[model samples]
Every structure is written in structure tokens, then in C-alpha cells.
Target chain A: MAVIHTDDSGDPRLDDFRHLSTADRRPDRPGGKGLVIAEGTVVVSRLLASRYPVRALLGVERRFAELAGELAGTDVPQYVTSAETMADVVGFHLNRGILAVADRPAPLTVDDVVTGAGTIAVLEGVGDHENLGALFRNAAALGVGGVLLGPGCSDPLYRRSVRVSMGHVLRVPFGDLTDWPGGLDDLRARGFAVAAFTPRPGSVPLRELREHAPGPVALLFGAEGPGLTESALAAADHAVRIPMPAGVDSLNIATAAAVAFYELASGG
Target chain B: MAVIHTDDSGDPRLDDFRHLSTADRRPDRPGGKGLVIAEGTVVVSRLLASRYPVRALLGVERRFAELAGELAGTDVPQYVTSAETMADVVGFHLNRGILAVADRPAPLTVDDVVTGAGTIAVLEGVGDHENLGALFRNAAALGVGGVLLGPGCSDPLYRRSVRVSMGHVLRVPFGDLTDWPGGLDDLRARGFAVAAFTPRPGSVPLRELREHAPGPVALLFGAEGPGLTESALAAADHAVRIPMPAGVDSLNIATAAAVAFYELASGG
Candidate 1:
């Protein structure tokens, strides 16, 4: 375990954790894919166990003690500081007493993630980071094999998402679909049925999704309000909907996805 | 429909809409029996359509115009004011240009909500107001009969819960389950099967819940981390679990409830 006790917040070793509030870390942003940050002991432990390259960790001494088991065999700098100083450096106190930053790992190809997967989630227009995170967490819990990001989706590794996912964003395999509706063809080619979720008339109920598209299903969803576009809906093999009472608005995208994922998860 | 325009934030008529951040209206708080509040045009429309006695509404002129249809035949005062004044009175900018407050209706007994309910949700230790509200929203959408709040549950009428529920909390029937574990016996006596959701071993997979319990069901859930208590689990006719991947944590309480509700919802 590499532990360095330091009371100073300005030390350059904490550079990756600085100005995180201004996390314009998108690929198009100036810094180019800012460090993937995991907050608190549970998430930090997940990050340390992930494939991403951990640069350093910053936290109060007590949190470090909680994380000591995960720190074994690691050579990364573990900077220990007081809560106030750590808050000053991270720009927030709710970082939950521990923060670990990691360099983004090599992107997994859609095929790499889809191979041998029984159930996968494919998303489009899911721009909200927290929804994205919650979706991943549900996916992980429900045993969805992989996630394929479609158009208009935000980066799942954004700090808020990582925390919300409870670091499952680091554990669950995900990759960009890149081809839009055309890319859905690849899923079909791999013997997977593409089931798009929508509330349109003639759509089958969620429970019947398995009957419409048998094994190895790819559950497709879109952002809540706009929902699945015509192109995406047409590309799918089946249109599934969670039966809602008349007059109620459609379920939130993430919650809708959880229901679908729960239905298709093996042994459920 | 009654519409009254006023620019003054201090108008005595706008008292229900005043200092909402303080939320001094909670019955247990300094203020007695706080009015149930609904924000945003969608939730506001729901409020107008709900059974709760609408006392008054405060919003920008445009929002009132948008809600003209739902407001029809309601003699309750509809106070129109500038967005700036609305912000000041509400103590927040994100009221979505509208707010509605209704007197807390007479408390419904457990039988009132459970009557003719084919499926119901029973919550234990669900103290988070947002989770409580979201559960109601899911129940409303998924066609669950009603919510019976077990011990340790919070008042779903809290401001954040109302917004999170998109005001479905106002529409769905809910009541306190004063009997605790004994209440499970009541549900069973009413020809309803009580199924508790847990991650505990030996619990049947959720999909089997319909087969095991069949017809009417009362799904029981606990707080997120410490799930349903031992007594509650023993009280249930069957213990059901969502299938999860090895090493993954359980789903969020509300999301888990939604998945369970979706499973038991008829014709879904």
C-alpha cells in the first residue's frame, strides 16, 4: 500500500482532483476526457479494482483506513488530508470523504461487450447523467450483460454518474454504438433480438417482450420526453411498453429500462 | 374558473404559497397540517384533477392560461402573479412557473385504500420522501391499488417527494398501516397474498411471485439498505427477489418496488 500523509491541498499530486466542478472533461472539452472520479469508500474500491488506471486518491485518514484493504499492492499516491483542506481542493464536501481519479480506459467495442451476452441495454438520447448512472446501476443489478450507448447519450463516466452508479459504471461493460439505427443491424447479426421500448399503440406489453423477441435480447430506450425516434423504432424487431394506466405520463426512462431489464434478466 | 391577478408578493391570499422552503406546514412541524404542494404544469394539472381540496393556486399568467381546462368549475382562488414575485414567495426559482397547494384531505383508513385493490404496495422503513413519492408514481402508472405506509415511512406530501412523484402522490390512494406485521394478516384475510421483496437467500425469484401468489397481492418493501425486517418477511405469504448478478448490490428501493409492481400488474 502506498500511503502519503499530507495536510497540504495545493500539492501538485492532487492536480487531477482540482477544479473538478469545472469538469469540462468531455472528449471535445479542452482537457480531453477528464479523470474518471469515484467518490466514497465503496465506489473508490470499485475503481481500484477496475481496468482504469488510477492516478491517485485523496481523503481524510479515516476513509483511508476504511479503504486500506483495497489499497494493497497499489503504487498509486494516496494523499491523506483533513476534511476542510480536502473540501477546499475538491470544491465540495459531499465527495463523501474519499475520492479516486483514474484515467479513462481503452474504449470497448460494441462487439466486445455484446459477445456471449444474454441481455444488453441500448440507449439513445439519454442525456441526463444521473439517469444514465441509475440505468447502469439497474443494469448491473438486473444482470444486463452489457450497455451500448446510442446517440444523444451523455458520457456515463462523468463524476455524478460514477457516484450515482455506485461505481458500477466501472464494472459494467459499455461502448458506443456509433452507427445509430444502422448499428442495430450488428446486434441482429449476432443473433440478438432488438426490442425498442415505447408507449405507442400496437406495442406489446413489457412482459411479452420475451415472446416477441426470444433469446439474447437488446432492450432499446430513448430519453424520457422525446422517446425513441421513428428511425430507431423501425429498426427494432419488437416494440415493447410497460403497461401504464390511462392518463399517467410515461415512466421515467431509467425506471422504464429497469422494468424491461428485470423482465429479460435470466432466471427472473 | 376563478382567476385573480396580483403583483404584490405580500398579499395575504398568497399565504399558502409563502416561504415554501421553510415548509412550516407539516403537521408535526411548527406549522400544523401543511398543505400538499404540487409544482410544474404537469403536476399542477394533476393537483387540479386530484381529490384533494384545492384551496388556491399561485403561478405566472401563462401557466394559468395553460391550465384553464383543468381549472374549469373550480371556485378556488387562482392567483396570477409575475414570475419574479412567484420566486420570492416560493423561495425558489424552479417552481416551473406554477404552484398549487391543497388542504390535506381527511386521512383514509387502510380499508378505504385497500378496497377493490387487486395489488397494493406496503412500505416499511421507507423514510426518504423522494422514494416514497416515486413509489406512489410507479404504483399509479403500474396500476397498483394503493400504498399502505408501514412504520418508519415518511409523509409522501413533502415538497421534494411531490415534485419527484410529479404529483402522483396526490392521485394515488395511500394510508397508514397501523397494525404493523399484523397488517399483513389483514391483507391475507382480504383474499390478497402478501409478498415481501428481499435479497435474502431462498427467496423465490420475482417472476414466480405471480405463480406463487396468483390473484390479489400486497407487495412489501423496506428501506434501501436494511431491507424488510425479519418479522415483516415472516409475515409475508412469500418472499420474492429480483434476480441479480453476483457481486452487484440491490436496486434502489423505489426502483425495486417498480419492478415488483410491474411484475404483479395485470395485463401489463
Candidate 2:
């Protein structure tokens, strides 16, 4: 490990660690070097273990000491600074106390992600970073084999999504499903039942959907309020709903997906 | 209906709606009404339908017209203000374009909440308003009869909780269990199996826990990080865990509760 103690918040060597709130948005930089940043010790450790190439780490001395085992053979520069200076450099008070930045790795193809998977989440219009991240976390926890991002979804590697997902975003395999409703046909061709989750009347309850599609399943979810679009719903082999009390709005998108994922993965 | 038009944002009649982000915290002031304020048409409608006595509403003319059916017989004041004026008074952009404030209703006793509850959620240290709200939403959706707050829990009626819950906080019954872990004994005495959810090893998986505690179960959850205190876990009749992928952290507290609540309430 190349350990470097730096006290100057504006040191040019730490340019990548500056103004993180805006750094992740630049599309014109090297390798889009607006790198994927993992905050907090837990997420930073996950980043170090992930396929993404770790560029460097900037955090407090205590945090660096905590990461000693993870950085045992790493030759990456580890900049140690005070919490206040780190906060000043990051343009926000990062209570997590540690941050690791990684270069974007090569994108995985859909086939690469689904080669040996039994269950996968296919999302549409799930633009919220936190929701997307939470979905990945649930997918990982419930044993969903992979994730396929349909149209209108945000990049899962976004920093907020990574942090909110507790870095499960790094563990779960996900790839773009560029064909929208048409791509769902590919899932069906691969012996997977495409069950779209919605609250529409006459839809089968999630319990029944699980009973019917008892094998490999691709659970399709849409944004919370608008729900799965008509084309997406019609494309699926079946429509599933979580039974809700009368007069209540549908559950949050991520929560609903978690329940569905749990049922499908757990055989309930 | 007391329909009044005010073009000026500074009108004294609008004092109740001023700087709404912080107004909800002032519970000690006269007409110091830490009134339950609902934003957006959906939540406002729920506020109108709840037991809380409606004080008044302020919104754009278009929004008022949309709520015409619900407001038809209301004798409460209705202040019509332009979007610009409403934003000025609220001290932020009011995209929902409507607001309603209601007087707090009589507090429900613990007995009032537990009287008919077969399946309930008992929260400890779940002080985050958004998590509390999401928990209520999940509870209402999954048919958890009520929520019982143990020590270190925040007020469910707080404004952020109300909003994040999509106003389900108004619908779901919740009251304090002031005695902490000891109150869990009361639940066991009432013939409700108190099942504490923890990620600790050797605990029964959630699915098995549901089957084992087949009736009148009280699902106990703790804050996200620390989980259930040893006292709370020791008091539980059964310590249950949601089976997660190896090496993954536990799910968010509210999401985990939703999954547990669904398992118990849905008879899976």
C-alpha cells in the first residue's frame, strides 16, 4: 500500500476526491473518471473486493487503520487526512468517514449476467437511485440470480445507489435489457416466466403467481405510481399483485419488489 | 366552506401555513397548533377523512377545484392562494400544490390499539421519520393490525413520517409501549407470540418462524444497525431471522419488517 499523509485539503493529488456531489456527474472525463465512489467503511471494503478497479482511497487516519487488512497488498495510494479536511474536500459532511473511488469496469452483457441465474429482476422506469439500489440489496438477500435493467432505469453504479444498497450493487450481477417489452421475449425463450408485478384489478395475487410460475422466474417491476406500462404487463406471462387493503395506495416500489422477490425466491 | 382569496403571501390568515418545514415542530404554540399538516391532494384527502378535526386548507384554485367533492360540506376555512404565494408562505416550492392542517385527535390508549390486533409490529429505536412512515405503509398494506412503539422510537405522527407513509400513518393504529422489553411480556400474556427479528446465528429463518408461531404474533424489530437489544431479544418468545445471502448485510429495518409482516399476515 502506498500510504500518503495529506493535510492540505486542496492538494492537486486529491483532485478526484473533491466536490464529490458533482464529480460523479461529469461524462466527459477520463474513463468517465468521475469514478464510482463508495462511502463509509462497509461500502469501501465492498468496493475494494468488487470487479471495479480501485483507483485510490481518501479518508481519515482511523478509517485507513480499519482498512489495513483489505489494503494489505494494494499498491493504490491511500491518502490520510482529518475528518474536517476530508469533509471540506468532499464538499459535504460525510458521516461515513471513509471513501473509495473506482474506475468503471467493463459492462457485463445480458447473457453474461443470466448464464446460470434462476431468478432475475427486470425493471422499467425505476429511475430513483435509492429504489434501484434497495432493489439490488433485496435481490441479493433473497437470492435473485441477477438484474436486467429495462428502459428508463438509472445507472446502478451511481454513488447514492451504491451507498443505499449497502454495496450489494457491487455483488449482484446486472445488465441492460435494451429491448423493453420485446426483450422480455428473450427471458421467456430462456425458460423463464416473465411475471410483471402490478396492482391492476384481475391480476393474480403474488402467492398465486408463485404457485403458477414455480420454476425460473423473471419478476418485472415498474416505477411505483405509474406501475408497469400496458405493453410491459401484456408482454409478461402473468400479472401479479400484492394484495393490499382497500383505499390504500400501493406500497413503495422497492418494498413491493422485495415482497415479490421474497415470495418467488423463497417458494412462498 | 369559508372560501377566502388572498393574493398577498404575508396575509395574517396564512400564518398557520408559513415556513411549513419547521412549522410542524412547534407543538407548544397557540393555534401554537403543531397541527397535522398534509401535503399533496392524496394525503390531504386522507387528512380530511381521518379522525383529526380539520382546521382549514390552503391551495391553488385548480387544486381546490379538484378537491371540490371532498370539500363540499366542510365548514372549515379554505384559503385560495396562487402557486407563487403558497410557495412563499411554505418557504419552499410546493409542487404538490395543496396543504391541509388538522387538530390532533384524542390519543388512543394502548388497550384501544391492541384490542383486536391479531398480528402487529413492535418497533424499538426506529426513530427515523421516513422509516417509521414506511413501516406504517407496510403495516397497512400487509394487514398488521397496529404498531406498538417501544423505547427510543420517534413519534409516528411527525410530519415527515406522515408524508413518507403517504398518510397511511393516519389510517394505521399505533401507540406507545412505554415499558420497553417488559411490555413484550404483556404481549405474551395476551396470547400473542412475541417474535424478535435478528440477524444473529441459530435463529429460526423467517418463513419457519411464521409457521412455528402460527397465530397472533407480534413481530419485533429494532433499529437498522444495532438491531434488537439483548434485553428485547431475551424477552422475545422466539428469535427469528430473515435468511439472507451469505456475506450480505441485513435489509433496511422497514423493508425487513415489511417482509416479515407479509409472511405473518399473508399466511405464507
Candidate 3:
């Protein structure tokens, strides 16, 4: 691996790390290449282990040394710069001194995701990037095999989402459900029970529903306020609720999803 | 009930709601007079049901009508304002277009919180306001009777925490653990098994730990990144983990807490 030491913030070689806040906005330019950027030592290490192709790394020398084992066999360029210069190029002061950028791998297909999975999360109208990322983290922790993004879900690869998810977004497999509620039929055909989570009256409590959908299950969640639409709820094999206290609004979308994931993982 | 129509944002009567971004900072105001402000209709309804002494409400008429049932018997002044004037007083444009201010009620005692609780969440070093709030929300949803705040925990009544918790912070009972690890002893004396959550090896998986701490468990958690301190973990009866996939970092603090709370409430 080549380690280049540079003190100049304006050096053209450092352009790929320039104005990173806006770099994600444009994907056409080499510097603005829309790469999957991982910040901090933990996330950077995950990026190295992920399937995405690492382009380069920019960090203080200390962080680079911390990653010595991960970088041993890789030939990617590692740029060493002062914290001041690194902050100037990144357009903000990042407390996490190390960052790694990787090229986006080919998108996974629904079949690729569900081929060997027993449990999955299907999200609808979960537009908040933090929530989307958090759901992935929860899914990964609770043993959910994959995630299917339905309508109105944001890109999990977004920088903020990646950060909020603590880089679990890179590890969890996800694919778009382009067919709306119709795609749910595909999941049903795959020997999975679709359970839509809502707080509406007559919905089965999550604990009881788990007994019925004991096999492979797809836990469907929607955004906090406007829960799963009528069609989405109707498409599921059953509707389940977490049984919140009376007079309380629903829990945050990510929190609700976490409880559901835990319920399914614990065999409710 | 005084239903006053006010067009002027600068009216002296509306000062309680003025520049609300910084209003909570004043220490001498009601509840130290800074006013426990609730934004959005859902939170406003929660404020109405809470023991806090209501002062008045300011909102667009549509939101006022949405809160009609909650405001029925209240004699506090209701200042109806246009969305623009409402924004002017609150120091920013609030899409919810509704706000309610109330005096803080007396703090609850630790005894009050623990008296009849079957399951509770005890937190330490959880200073992040949003995390604290999220914990309370999870505690409420999962039927954790109360929360005990150990050292380094932030105030659950803080504005941002309340908002992030969707006002559940106001509903859940919480008290500070003034005696540090000693307070945990008090819980143990009350026949509650205190289980400290950690990611370290040798800690029992949460599912198995729940069986050991079967009756009236108190699940202790710490802030993200830096988990439960050595002293806090040592004070507990046993250390527990969520059985995450190997190589994955721990789940978010609130998410982990939610899973534990769910396990305890759902009879393990």
C-alpha cells in the first residue's frame, strides 16, 4: 500500500475528499464520484471487510496505523494529512479522524436477498434516513436475514444513514420492492408469512401473532404517523401490534421495528 | 375557559411562549417558570392529561379543534393565533402549528416508581437527551413500570428529550439514583434481580439471563459506545448480552433497552 504524506489542503490529489457534504450530491465527477464513504475506525474497518471496492483512505497517521491489519494486503492509496488539513478538505471537523471511500457494488436482487433467509423486514414510507439506517442495524443485530424496501423508503447508502446505522447498512443485504403490495405476493409464494404491524383495533398482539406465523416471517413496518397503507396491511397474512399503553402515540418507527424484530427473533 | 383571539405575536400575554428555542434555558421561570412546552397535537394532549399545571395554549384554529376534547374542562386561556404569528413567538416555523405550556409537577420518588413495578429499566451514563427520551418511550411501550436514572443520566423533562420521546417522557415515572451503586442494592432488597447489560465475553445471553432473573427484573443499561461502567456492572447480580451476530458492534442503547424490556414483559 502506498502512503502519501501531504500538507497542502488544496492539492489536486486530495480532491476526491473535497467538499464531501456536496460531493454526494453529484455522481458525475471523479471527485464527486458518489462513493460510499465510511467514517471512523469501526465503520472504516467494516467498509474494508464489505464487498464494496475500496478506492482510497484519508486519515491521520495514527488511525492508519490502527488499521494496519486491515490494510496489510490491500494496495489502495492511503493519504496521510494533519487533522486541520483533513477537516478543511472534508468541509467539516470530523471527530472520527479516519475515513474510507468505496465504489458502490452492483445492487442486490430480491431473489439474491431472500434465497436463504428465514426472517426479513419490509419497510414502507420510512423516508427518514436515520430510521432507515437504524432499522438495518436492528435487523442485523436481531438476526433478520434481509430487508426489502417498499415505496417511500430512502437510500440506506446515504452518508447520514450510514453514520446513524453505525455502518450496519453496509453489512445487511437489502433490495427494492418495486411492485408495491404486489411484491408482498412474491414473498408469500416464497413460503413466508407477511405480518403487517399496526396499532389499529382488532389487530393481533405481536406475541400471539408470532405463534401463528412460526415459520419464515416478513415483518412489515411503516413510518410512524401514517402506518402501513390499507393495501399494504390487507396484503399481509396478519396484522400485529406491540400493545402500547392507552392514550399514547405509537413508538418511534425505529423503536417499533426494534420491538418487532426482537419479538420475531425471540420466537415471541 | 378564556378563548382569546390574538393577532399580535408580541402581546405580553404571549411572552410565556416567546422565543421558545431558548425559553427552557431560564431557571427562574414556572416549573422554574420556563414552562413545560409541548409542541404538536399529540404532545399537547399528553400535557393536558399530565399533572403539570396548564397555563395556556397557542395554536392555529385547526389544531385547537383537534385538541377540543382535552381542552373541554380546562379554564386556562387558549390564545388562538395565525400560523405566522405562532412561528414568530416560537422562534421558528413549526409545522405542527400548536404549542402548550404548563408548570412542572413535583418530582416522583424512587419508592413511588418501584412499588408495584414488575419490570423496570435502570440507566446510567445516558446523558444524551434523545437517548434518555427514547428509553422512556420504549419503557412505556413495553410496559416497563418505571425508569431509574443512575449517574450521568440527563433530565428526561428537557425539551428535546420530550419531543424525541413523543411526550412519553411526561407519562413515564422516573427518579434519579442519588446513591450511585448503592441504590441498586435497594432494588435488590426489594426482590428485584438487577441485570447489567454488556457485550463482554462471559456475560450470559439475555434470553437465558431472563430465565434466571425471572420475577421482577431490573435491566440496567448505559450510554452507547461506552457501556455500563465497571462499578455499575459489578453491582448487578449478573451481566447479560443480546446474542448479537459475531463481529457486529452492540445495538443502539435504546434499541437494546427496548429488546430487553420486551423480553421481560413478554414473560421471557
Across B167-186, the per-residue lDDT of candidate 3 in tens digits comes to 88888888887899999999
Docking class of 3: medium
Given the true complex, what DockQ would model 2 score?
Answer: 0.86
- Local distance difference test scores for all models: 0.87, 0.88, 0.87
Q: Per-residue CA lDDT of candidate 1, range B106-130, in tens?
A: 8899899999999999999999987
Best by DockQ, which number?
2
Q: By TM-score, how accurate is candidate 3?
A: 0.94
Per-residue lDDT of B266 in model 2: 75
TM-score per candidate, in order?
0.96, 0.97, 0.94
In candidate 3, stretches whose alpha carbon ends up further than 4 angstroms from where it belongs are A27-33, B27-34
Q: How does the DockQ of candidate 1 come out?
A: 0.80
Q: Which stretches in model 2 have alpha-carbon errors above 4 Å? A: A30-33, B30-33
Which scores greater on TM-score, model 2 or model 3?
Answer: 2
lDDT of 2 at A103: 84
- Model 2 Cα lDDT, one tens digit per residue, A1-268: 6989988998988888889888768768765536789998899998899898988899998888898899999999999999999998999998888888888888899898887888899999999999999998888888988999999999898888998888989989999999878999998998899998888899898878867887889999999888888999989999889998899878888899888878777765
Candidate 2 clash pair list:
B29-B32
* Evaluation by TM-score, superior candidate among 1 and 3: 1
Best by TM-score: 2
